[model samples]
Target: MTEMTLDPRQLGTGGLFTAAVPDLASHEAAYGRRPSGWTRSPLLRELEASGLAGRGGAGFPAWRKLAAVGAGRPAVIANGAEGEPLSRKDTALLRQAPHLVLDGLVTAGEAVGASELFLYATAESLPGVGQALAERRDGPRVTLVEAPAAFISGEASAVVNALETGTALPRDKAARIARSGYQGRPTLLHNVETLAHLALVARYGAQWFRSAGTADDPGTRLYSLSGDVPAEWVVEAPGGASLRDVLRLGGAEPSSLAAVLVGGFHGAWVPAEAFDLPLTARGLARYGASPGAGVLLALARGRCGLQASAGIVRYLAESSARQCGPCMFGLPAMATVLERIAAGERAPWLASEAERLAGLVTGRGACHHPDGSARFVRSSLGVFKDEVRAHLAGACTAHHGRV
Candidate 1:
């Protein structure tokens, strides 16, 4: 097993985790009393005006998610299930600021007139969350569910499935989780980081929330940085931050890295030349990368990028829920081909075969598992093309094999 080195750091002043909000009183002191009496329409307007997007991989508008639930009793979930292997921001947030997350869950519940609220997180975070719940006297009752240590468990459908059934595998993708989910009720699920941000938005108002980040991408974001850095850190930075600045915050010099995985295991790769690019969807679109899950993994210059990508692809293939043909067969086949190419297989057909397999699995999974896995593998091939050529010539261009 790979060792998880999770250290939390904040970029500027007054952002997430900068305050010591370990318990309820401290949280209240830092953020003031939770703004109450916010109904659906009003809350939607506030979120929309705030321009807050989900900190989760998708970056969907938070207001739209609440509006989608429509009327009737809804279920709200604070998803702290940080199942991405290289991501630890959610776990750090849950441990350090559980009350804020709980407040956000309650805020969302109030907005949707939700009948049930759940805070689902990994075991490492449950104790703090449970304590936060115990500390709270006002607000709707929140049930605590332990999240399993599986990659796909953090997917929205899988989260609902985990609550309905013991297994944390994703169900049908066609079904709209917002309309019918978790015991066939309307469910609004937001990542823990997003909810924490929402909690801040609720208190600070839209303009105040928009004050930090760029006009296009508003508010702050929590990023989990690792891979060839001096240390693993969960850092908070303004939205649309430059990758170079983020690396510097994580104790890594951008010049020393060959490339950086902008997202997590299921994310895309960006060459170091583009390190100056903003960590936003539009900014990274050309590179086939985004701030997905707010994960930035630095690949040091002398490390074998292909070898590192191959290992991650293999892990993703093995982590699949295996509920659909793409996950059950296509991912493993893709992984095998990628591994062969990374292992100095001289065959020219290897790269094309990998591409073919990726196409076969794209958009065919029950969840985004197969698609994300394919994305990672395809990005590896594109970003490490030079390495691929060297390997095809039965040689390696990396100064060292470490990644």
Candidate 2:
């Protein structure tokens, strides 16, 4: 697998994982005491009231995913396999606030009738998890499974396949893993941060969880803010906070940016006009933006958006699992056209042809890889409309050179 080099830094003042060395006793003190007994059904109802959503990019409702856990021995897998190149909040949380994440894992495991809790993490994150696990004298049955660092390796299906089949590729089957996962039993999986919030929700109840952000997208979330910033920061803000506010928290001046990629590579592109929208799932949906994996990347002033996009597309092409024809063929084709357009090629069919290629591969692959790639391409086209026109007119606003 190819190694992606990116900054994995964090803010020292945030609520979670900002500590240099957070201990278990301090975690318990900050979040209040833990529960001795937990019932799955009641906890599910509480989660429904909390309006909590998954932090694993998709933002699916947490209560609903827990409800899908099948009858047999269930499992809770904490996904610390944060594979998005521009994201590093999970890594920071695992290293800094491990006990809180562990509280979440143990709490969630009991809520789902899970026989054991699985901690799936990239190899780089193991030492901290190991340190925390070693500190724990007693807890639920917890096991750590190290995963190879790759973009798709953190995906739910891929994580399952890695454990069951020893391959990090996503399963070709169409069924949801919540019903049949991890030893052919029901599984309750959550991103590392989301599970931490569950520990909060279990103690404070849903109303307390809903008190911070909007009613639709309640609670606070962590955002890995990078690209063109003086320093990278992992911020914890309310769910519906404006992108403008989040950017400021990340030490970015909104006026200085050409555009910002609200999500990671597989997410949307929003120009400054869309910056006013809230960073919530429902709010960003108004502008077709997904705060996927809570990544906020701003383009450097005068940096070529087209060139940057083409480079990202090429990375997506290189990272494909090659299971389906569309992912294997369509992505590389899209990247080629994108690189050409970024080079100030005066081809009229380039924009339309890029869209056509994206459509052919979208929603046609076994995993969401093709669909995500298409979203990235479609949003880039709209966000860089003026840039696209300039390229077609044989002029370059940023630079004509290749990425």
**lDDT of all predictions:** 0.84, 0.81
TM-score of each: 0.95, 0.93
lDDT of 2 at 22: 69
Clashes of each: 0, 0
Off by over 4 Å in 1: 1-21, 400-403
- State the TM-score for model 1: 0.95
The positional error of residue 145 in candidate 1, measured at the CA in angstroms, is 0.4
Candidate 2 per-residue C-alpha lDDT over 10-104 given as tens digits, one digit per residue, 9 for 90 to 100: 11123444435666666666655567477779989999999989988888888998888887888889999998888888887788778778877
Give the clashing pairs for model 1: none
**Ten-residue region with minimum lDDT total, candidate 2:** 1-10
Clashing pairs in 2: none
Query: Weakest 10 consecutive residues, lDDT, candidate 1?
Result: 1-10
